[model samples]
Target: MSGIVIVGAGECGVRAAFALREHGYKGSVALLSEEMHLPYERPPLSKQCLPAHKPIRPKADYQQAGIELCLRTRIEALDLAGHRLLGRDGSSRIYDKLLLATGARARLFPGMEGAATLRTFDDACRIFERLRAGARLAIIGGGFIGLELAAAARAMDVQVTVIEAASRLMARGVPAEIAAIVEARHRAEGVDLRLGMQVAALVAGGVEIADGSTVAADIVVAGTGATPNTELAEKAGLAVGNGIMVDSRFRTSAPDVFAAGDCCSMPYRGDWLRLESWRVAQEQGAHAAAAMLGAVGEWTTVPWFWSDQYDLGLQVAGWAAAEAKTTIRHLSDDAAVAFQHDDEGRLICAAGVGRGNRVAKDIRLAEMLILREARPPADQLADPTFNLKSLLKAA
Candidate 1:
């Protein structure tokens, strides 16, 4: 069976497999997963998959598509010269082309045996068991995953105390204004947010702080961050920097080997950037499949991500620099939209927070402007009376 061998079974790997068939590729496809379960989406793990234990698709679905699903299989060595992949259990497979969709893994705290990180479905199940009513949860990060889990715990009637090293929540992703809004929302939802705090050590009951303070919690979870799974690529002598370095076509330095998703970093805006969003992963996967079929085109889609907390929805499209000129538009007393532009006045990113429908509309307009790199006056953008939909016509 020599065709395409995808090294991972995450969203990117699964999408690549389906995309190959869609693109009229008659070659065989094998999706290898180190886990026993079928390929599943990770976003639901922090949102609803824990409460509702379900698989994204049944095993029969893959079989019907003529894709081989190799479960609980690990590719220990990559013989790039021979186009062969050696497995740990003395199994080997030859691939005409290889796609490295090996996604990232959660960062675990040292000596924190009881603390868990939500990366896999199994991890979500364990975390769900611990999130009982009246149970105290101490989260040790303020990123999206940590805050989302906090909201989920609060919904379950579990007391949550978030310990963040940064002064604001999601400092790396959201701007100051958005972070303030999110922090306020969490506080109103009865989430005890401990900002500018560091966990010196994790004890049985809770965690010890840097200032000789201790918070008692029934369970502790760390959502610090994720590290790219690039060990296999590095071992195969591929160009590894921050992640497996790939070009705009998802082609790696090694011939006939392509990488996508969180495992690969591509050149963007004169810098190497690795996006961990599910949408980007799927898009890159499809693009990679097209490139593998000799239909190469540089990926040019704008990146966007969304989060749901309590009753509010937040959406951001494209990248916003810290020094970028910003404009704000208010849809209501509590709901607002914002746009960021570079010094040259080109729209770089847009963010909105509001009810589902309103935010979705605003985000769509902003995404259009970003895709076009449109430069509109800051005042005109901030005016709520202005019709943002008109930008699409102008573009």
Candidate 2:
């Protein structure tokens, strides 16, 4: 009998597989993965002080759920019209409904094919093996992955240098005010920061800067961001843009096929957004599973993500534009939350940073406020004593 099939076997795919059962579909569920290992958590790869691999769920869980877990399976082509997936091993899997949660791959630096990138558990193991104390490591990019790696390496007593083409760290989404605090923490931890510097090439022993100076390193890692794994979707003649395009329900251009997580882009607040957050992947997986089960509703989960560097914890909810009006709430000397409001005074985004989950409660509340379209007063947001929970009730 044909059943539901999910591709990729990352957080999204695994979550959707379980969600399908939770939502009472009760049909056969099969999860296919290109990797040989069990579906593992990808976030801890960059932050763990020691080499560790954590599976999303144990092997017994899938067996108990009667979900067919197939690893080292690669789908070469998609026969969308036939509702079939052509495998690389001369096999085929027919599905009543298919989910493409293929996730994303790391963007490598030009001519740096040999440089290490932390995307998979195997990749993390290789990097960790080389991260001995006093070893010099140079990371290309100042984004979350790079910074998190720097922090982890520092904890291991490894020397770290972060190289960024942009003028500031996390230039893509994080605000400058919060970025400055992160920069300060990294500096205090003895990380050598090279901002606004272009990489000329990957030299024999280090990275060559645009100015002809080579940053010496025993190990080089590229945290240059990720690109969606949408080749299969594109080949199947589905709508493709920055990622596989889907509607509110995650339905692809073709029938009986859907997508979610980093592999797909959906409409958000007037434009299409492709988010790479772990929380987004999990939430979208459940949402898409319900969609596959004939549920109809808009995917309105707010875009949220968090990062850890040393003792600092940073979280951001919703989309913060550069021109949005901002208000700051000082939680402590080293902790603060920034709220961004649109012209109509509606809460659009919120960001917070503090020591060890200090700002987690506030950021979570701000996320709820954004979802409710709350136009909380600026003074209330700025005042530390004003309980954010009250704002949620008012909304």
Candidate 3:
């Protein structure tokens, strides 16, 4: 039947399917997944110890919602002109409206095809199985994925050696001040951190560094980053840049076709931003579903993300540009929050690192302030005794 078809079954695709029903759309909805198993949560794969694969929604839930869930279905061709999806098995599906939520694939290092990369539940399972106590684990790339896995490996008594090409961890978005706290915590947990080192290639025992040195390891994993899965969209002749280009309303260049999540890049404040966060995927999916059903609005939610390593929790809201003016608020010993404001003193971004969600409340309030464009005084933001909620009230 020709109806709404979501071309992926990740968080964005699954959320879009349910959101269509929730928004009172009395139409057929089909969620297609190339995976053999049901849609599962991916965030916990690196955080929890041998975490049980938790499905985003039980099977019965989809049946009750009248959403057809297709597993092991790979769409090989997209006939955008004809509005049809061609499957590998000579099967075809017609859709009146389509959502491309293919997500992204792990970026692999050249000549290291055997090295593990965590993108699927099966990948996580294999990595965890190999991470036994006393095993020497070598992780290349000190980004969020590599660092989080390092923390998990250390907790299991495994020796982890993190090799980062950059001078510090999480250099992409996190400020150096916050990255220092994360680095200190990792070191305290007995993690061997090798900074400012470029990986030459994979050697017999472990990885070879550019300095003609090698780190011995039982297993090697690459956590460089991810490349968006834009092959299907590109083959279909969609405008593809860093990702599938979409507007603020999640509308692609083609009519009746939408994309969201890591697979798509939408416009922000005078720029195009493609975020790879769980919250963004969830929010974008719901917002795109509403937009598909004639909702007239733009997806202007403030970008935010969080990470957990050992006992420390880090949360960041908005873009914390390195060149932006920063104000610090001391929460406690070894814990503090940083706020970035523009030249006009408008709150642009906030980042906080503390023990176990201690910075969550303030960071959330800061997100609201950013959304409201509240320009509280720098002195007020720097004072820990000053409640951030008061700024919201005053605004």
lDDT against the true structure, per candidate, is 0.87, 0.93, 0.91
Q: Relative to the unseen true structure, what is the C-alpha lDDT of residue 297 in candidate 1, on a scale of 0 to 100? A: 88
- C-alpha root-mean-square deviation, each candidate: 1.5, 1.1, 1.1
| Predicted structure 3: clash tally | 0
Error of 1 at 199 (Å): 1.8
* Candidates sorted on lDDT, descending: 2, 3, 1
- Candidate number achieving the greatest lDDT relative to the actual structure: 2
For model 1, what is the C-alpha lDDT against the true structure? 0.87
Q: Give Cα distance to truth, residue 73, candidate 3, Å.
A: 0.7
State the lDDT of candidate 1 residue by residue for 278-353, as single tens digits. 8889999999999999886898888888887777788888875777777888788657877888878888888777
* Ten-residue region with minimum lDDT total, candidate 2: 107-116
TM-score of each: 0.96, 0.98, 0.98
- True-structure lDDT of candidate 3: 0.91
lDDT of 3 by residue, 1-395 (tens): 99999999999999999999999999999999999999998999988768569999999999999999999999999999999999999999999999999999999877567778998999999999988899999999898889999999998999999999999888886877788888999998999999999888888889889999999999999999999999999999999998999999999999999999999988887788889999989999999999999975999899999999889999999987878898888898768888998888888899889999999999999999999999989999889998889899977
Candidate 2: which stretches are off by over 4 Å?
none
To one decimal, what is the Cα RMSD in angstroms of model 2 from the true structure?
1.1
On the 0 to 100 scale, the lDDT of residue 372 in model 1 is 86
